[model samples]
Target: MIVPSSNLTMETELPRMLRAREEAEPGDRFVFHSARARMQHVTPEQLLAMNQQATRAAAELADGRPDVVATACLVAIMAQGPGYHCTAEDDITGALRAEGCSAPVVSSAGALLSGIAALSARKVAILTPYMKPLTKAVADYIEDAGIEVVDAVSLEVPDNLAVARLDPADLREHHRKLDLARADALVLSACVQMPSLPAIQPVEDEVGIPVLSAATATAFRILTELGLPPRVPGVGRLLSGVEEPAA
Candidate 1:
């Protein structure tokens, strides 16, 4: 995974989710390696700067000969504006190919889009860890891609490290605050750095709709790119291994 330098949750959440996958499929063993791009605050300047370092980060991960590479930072990609995920993924893939590693690349930004489509959700309510402006930017990016954001709640977090320190359990309460009556799905945590795995199931069960996070979507896309079923326990329907018809 290529993650922001200050991100603390991706390494923890991703491995835990994959470990849960290991429980269901004993034959699939896993090891995680990460490459970091410098970032400390969740501001636009830092996000763009951090993204500029992707090629170098991808080079570092290419040495690992990873079967699939995933960029775990969601905001950094979206901050570049709509449709940036396609460019970002292609750039990372090119970097990997230059290193003689022909691995499929995934970005959390693109994965979230694909995950939403897979669930056939036309409208969504999202919970994000960014400040209001950034949150609006994320909502805009998604909306420009054709999904209507029925409602969006920003926790207004700015410090990158602080976003990681937020308790996942707190997301359950945040879920209650969203106006989900018109939402076909919920993006429980729009920012990958903000942990949300533990809350995914509870939120889904309560709302009776598809629920997913940037991390879970990236994980599902990773397995999908690997030609494996995206069956990971405890995450929501996207990774339930049972495929849903696309929108």
Candidate 2:
């Protein structure tokens, strides 16, 4: 996975979500390798500039012989408007190909969309650690991908490192603030930098809806694209072998 230099949650949560069941053999376990695209803030300008390093990050991840690579930034891709993951994925592919690597690539933005679709989610509620403008952009991006944003709550956090410092338990109040009456799914962490994995299942149990985060969705996309059984327990409903039409 490739992420912003200051984003810390993906590296921790993604690996936990990707781990196979304990009964599985060693060969069934998946290892993750990551590279950072220089970024220290979650603002639009910095995010747009961050894409300039994705190709280089892809090339660096390619050096590890990874079977799949993912650009693990949600708002960064969504900030480019709808359907940018295709172009972004193509850019990474070209960069990796140039380095004699042909591994498939996925983006956190696309993965989140795919994951919501897999859960058959239509109307959704989302929580983000981004400022209001970027949160609106993320909601617009998700809506453009065919999901309705019924409600959205932004923590209004500006500093990238501070987002990483937020405790998962603190998200419970934010989750309750969303008007989920008409919502079919809840995006607990629309930004990968914010910690939400520990809150996902509990929020789902309380709200009685499928809960997911960018990190869990990205791991699901990676396993699905790799043709592995997309089953990882204690994460959420999307990873429980849910199926949808291919992207």
Candidate 3:
């Protein structure tokens, strides 16, 4: 995984879900590797700078010869403008290829889009740890992809580490602020570093809608890219190998 220097939750939450996967698939073992991109805040300038280091990170992660590679910061790519995830993935692929690494790449930005579509969600509401402007960028990026963003709530945390420190339990409350009545799905955590793993299932059950976070979406993409079933226990609908649990 390629993660921001200050991101603390991706390593924690991603492994938590993958470890749970071990319960269901005891034969499948898992290991984690990451390369950090320097970042301390969630601002556009900082995100852009953090993104610039992804290719290098990709090369480093590829050297591990992992089956698949993924990026953890979603809005970092989204804030780059709509559809930047493709470009980011392409760039990372280029770097890995240069290192003679052929691992499949999954960008969290693209994975979030894919996960939502896999659930057949056309309209959605999202919660982000970024400021309102960055949150708007995320919503616009999704909207440009033909998905409707019925509501978006920004937690307004600028410090990247602070975003990681946010309590996942609080997401149960934050999600209620969205106009979920018009949404087919709910993105509990638009930012991977925001730590929504614990709240995802609970919120989905209460709201009677599909719930997913950037981390879970990335996990789904990673497993699928490896030609494995996307099923992972207890993270949310996208990784549950279900055809939209809300339905």
Cα RMSDs, all models: 1.2, 1.4, 2.4
The TM-scores, one per candidate, come to 0.97, 0.96, 0.96
**On residues 176-242, what C-alpha lDDT tens digit does candidate 1 reach at each position?**
8999999999999998899998999998998899999999988888888888888998789999985
Residue 120 displacement in candidate 2 (angstroms): 0.8
Clashing pairs in 2: none
Total backbone clashes of candidate 2, pairs 3 or more residues apart or in separate chains: 0
lDDT of 3 at 113: 90
Q: What local lDDT does model 3 show for residue 163? A: 89
Writing each residue's lDDT as its tens digit, candidate 2 over 130-162 gives 889999999999999889999999999899999
Model 3: per-residue Cα lDDT at residue 97: 92
Off by over 4 Å in 3: 243-247
Q: Which stretches of candidate 1 lie over 4 Å from their true place?
A: 244-247
Report backbone clashes per prediction: 0, 0, 0
* Cα deviation of 166, candidate 1, in Å: 0.7
Candidate 1 or 2, higher lDDT?
Answer: 1
